[model samples]
Target: MHPPTWLTAFLDLPADEFDAAVAFWQAVTGYSLSAYRGEREEFATLLPAAGDAFLRVQSVESGPAGVHLDLHAPDQVFEVRRSPGGLAYCLVSGTESERPAPTTWEDGNRSQVDQVCIDIPPALWDDECAFWASATGWELVQGGRPEFRRLRRPARQPLNILLQRLDEPDGPVRAHLDLSADDRAAEVRRHERLGAQVDRVHEGWTVMRPPAGPVYCVTGRVPSADPT
Candidate 1:
């Protein structure tokens, strides 16, 4: 079988705001910084204390901040698509070196990014989902809600992808990260202390806005299992 694809979450930010974004994210995710990449120094990777890194930050020349994914498949290539607001993703071939496994945080708070939700315009929902499904070779599962669909990775994979169909068909497509937390309330508080403001609460999930970054969610889902 082909090796499991390595997934990395990319946080795209304005050039001027990139540093603040990286600092905020590093604190919230408990990750350290890796040397910047790209000729323009627009790329930086977030390294977990152990295990493969699944997060990165990029400074874009223009446009509002957003999120996207990078899939590293040894010998695969995929077409890139740009949405209304310039959101796009591409798959490239590369080898991912393994790292030390992750351990519990010193503060004893446990959290990890377990899902990425792509917000797509209703008109492009089917096509977008098809593209991602094809790129990742993940199975598409019907979502519990009418406007949602899930592209689940294999059991051995470390992250999941979700597609959310928006009511407005002309809006820009964007994405956000979802972190699993064992103690939802405490996790929210921890992020708040680190400069994230609670945007609102939906169901049992807390929508948070980082000091100067895109919004993300902290859910009560267990970090060690598939999110409900």
Candidate 2:
């Protein structure tokens, strides 16, 4: 099957912190807010001023705040069938919409969310990696380090999938988006100005916390032209 065309990186925040989380993300990504969704206004799409939305923020009833991916396909059941081993995912219909082309912000930084990294416990690491590989039709390759694995999508796809094996074997699964930037340091500074705290720098990538949101990374990579 052909891979899906749309991908959304979702930030699941604690119910009380939703507003702050949305504000922080909007400032950092320079995206405008789409109309709020859900019964209690628990969902919102973070749309780039000119591009397809690859990010969203949601308020969850419980559990630690984290991230997940929403892959839009013509047949939701087909996509779900690709995932096995109890991966936490759902298939929703009628959620697709048109998006504008991507544009760069005044900071001279064009950001593209090019990767989604799933934090998997040791026991489930292999299975999870395999599932993502099957679901995306992406090749599973070893990452730069042992603890990391990557599901590299075809060149045409907008995002890559990564599986990071965590040392802890008994925690909830979490995910994070990796933004590729032309100038890593400058982008990090820009995000800092928008209320993101630098948690630490690993290798050359900067790990950041957006106000009350979960952590994500800024890496030194050329932003892909296709923003969706």
Candidate 3:
């Protein structure tokens, strides 16, 4: 497969929680909702003020509600498939070039929803990481910790791929969004004000559960760094 020209993270919400999920995400990301599309009006793009949007929300009729990534490349028919570790991803033809700026909070802290962390069972870790690095044609940067591996994203690409080695012996692969913030605590507090709750606070990142979707993390990384 050709290297993706762009990457977009999609929050797939169930029908019953669609509106609430859209509202919560829009509030946290400071993005304006675009007109709903799709046959059932179940898809909407989150438009950024200064750059091309790299995020969207969709109402799903079946299957689990969670996040998925869209790999955008030029001149291709849309296709969806499961990764070696079983995470679902889409290949779309639409092209995107601009990357959105991080949102600056009232407290002078900045944050961006920049990375998608794939949680893979220990046995699947090696193959999963190899598949992603080859599939995306991005530089694979070995993580400092043994449990993590990151893709060194291209300059214009909006999202980073993080492969997390789970401790479990075997299980279905899953993914979660992660926000890098200048001040992790402040960002967590802001999200809490928007109806999110702290799930756990680790030394390097804070786990958070939004009012209406799967859990994510607020990490202590710089908002502006592409983690290149």
Q: Can you write out model 2's per-residue Cα lDDT over 1-228, one digit (the tens) per residue? A: 445555667788998888888888777666789999889888898876664566778899998787777777776553333243344554444244444333477866677667888888887887788877776667899998899999767644556787889889666667888888878888888888888889999885889988887889998766766533
Q: Encode model 3's per-residue lDDT on 1-228: one tens digit a residue.
A: 668999999998989888988999999998899999999999999998877888989999987678998988889679998898788999999777888888887888889999999899999988999989988999888886888899998887888899899989999989999999888888888999999999998888899998887789999888774322
- Model 2 Cα displacement at 189 (Å)? 1.0
What is the TM-score of candidate 2?
0.84
Worst 10 residues of 1 by lDDT: 97-106
Q: Write the per-residue lDDT of candidate 1 for residues 1-228, one digit (tens) a residue.
A: 233467778898998888999999888777899998889988988887766777889999988888887777787666455644456875656566443232345667678877898988987788888877776778888987888899877754557788889988677778999988778888889889998999999776899998886899998776773222
- On the 0 to 100 scale, the lDDT of residue 41 in model 1 is 84
**In model 3, how many backbone clashes occur?**
0
lDDT of 1 at 154: 71
Candidate 1 regions with alpha-carbon error over 4 angstroms: 1-4, 76-86, 97-107, 225-228
Task: Give candidate 2 misplaced runs (Cα > 4 Å).
Answer: 1-3, 75-87, 94-103, 226-228
For candidate 3, report its TM-score. 0.96
TM, every model: 0.87, 0.84, 0.96
Error of 1 at 199 (Å): 0.7
Candidate 1: give the clashing pairs. Answer: 51-100
